[model samples]
Target: MLSQPFNPLPLDELTAVFARIKDLLLTQDKVDRALEVLVQAVGDAIPGSAGAGISLFDAHGRGSSIAATALVVEQADAAQHDLGQGPCLAAWTAGTTVLIHDAATDARWPLWSEAVASLPVRSLVSTPLAAAGGPIGTLKVYASLPAAYTSATGQLLEKFAVPAATLLAHIQGPGTPRHLSGPLKGALAGRDTTNRACGMLMERDGLTAEQAFHELLRRARTSGAPLSRVCSDLVDGRA
Candidate 1:
């Protein structure tokens, strides 16, 4: 039998949680560990989220899949790469939260609609990871049921945007010489490769890093290729 779903946090408790979340984000240490902490906290903080993922876009416009729980982010990333639709892309593009309360019935992306219906992703909330200039990428959460989030919940996630953006900027900023910091320190091993791939596309196609990365994701989806493998081939001159 299916287990009963988790209960929503009461208003008082939710307020306290947001307070704590705010305090944590204000700290340099906590900001550094934002990615890891986000995934761990999202499930408990939000009533419907089964998992979450944080994607960071580097200076060269390449995306590094940093923190992820289960396959929610991974598959969502794939869907973005594949069909070029969904809340993640919207958030990244708009530099704001993209709320899809009903994926199956939404007319936003017909291709994504059919694809996500096959998965357990009935609802989604994607908040942009921004910096001083604009959006860097997205922090996305997935739920198995539609209309799982309320306006309050969406507002809560929005409250997280400023701190989250600051954290990302600190780590990947041009002013910072350091490569990794806080929670993103040991997240992925292929970051350099992804960067190299982005650089190659920039050099060869005269595309901006962001444009190149988007193109790479587009290619990966159209050809049904894994992102790392695609980057490897680009680095090795095979693709």
Candidate 2:
């Protein structure tokens, strides 16, 4: 519910912005780095944005802030995760865009709003990162001014969502390119399996996302096996 009137970017400017993003995407070597850069791009592309962050949900729906332009953005996302509420989490879980004109006066998530009210953030917008199955994460931009985001801003962000989700899925999915070295391919597979295992643990045992990840690492060490193998075994119910 932004109070400000929507200001659409001129077609030429919007085209150039996307062109720059395409170049940035090509330069990224890793999914994590790509997501970080994408959030930075969002901050740069949109007016009135102070910072940006990516909120990723594991398969079990537990949210974690993967990247942020500033410490305040990270803190704000963390508050939402800790409280089990916030626009980012809502966007990810519900697969919809969310906007908070002013967190201090936004009554939908009172606890989350109150918690982050002390921070420098005033307005926020979160868009769902839709994957093949559904939304797997959220892309969020924070502003220090109230009513900073408008309908045009939301539309612009929606255009970026597809590419962002695709990049993440490419890294985590099983279809590694044949050009990658054997070791590198194995490393990516291991990371993806570990993430899946962590998600499974969270859902089955009601553990927090961080706790589940640590548990996987500890079990892998105790079993004297590669983390990937351990995760695979867990997924197959063999461990």
For every model shown, what is its TM-score relative to the native structure? 0.59, 0.65
- Candidate 1 — worst ten consecutive residues by lDDT sum? 179-188
Q: What's the lDDT for all of these models?
A: 0.65, 0.71
lDDT of 1 by residue, 137-215 (tens): 6777788888876566566666555566665555543333343443233223355676678788888889865567677
Candidate 2 residue 10 C-alpha distance from true site, Å? 5.7
With a 3 Å backbone cut-off (N, CA, C), the pairs that clash in candidate 1 are 32-182, 32-183, 33-183, 60-209
State the lDDT of candidate 2 residue by residue for 203-237, as single tens digits: 99998655675577678668877666778899889
Specify the poorest-scoring 10-residue window by lDDT in model 2.
Answer: 179-188
Q: How far is candidate 2 from the true structure (C-alpha RMSD, Å)?
A: 8.0
- lDDT of candidate 1 vs native? 0.65
Q: Which stretches of candidate 1 lie over 4 Å from their true place?
A: 1-34, 58-62, 172-239
Best by lDDT: 2
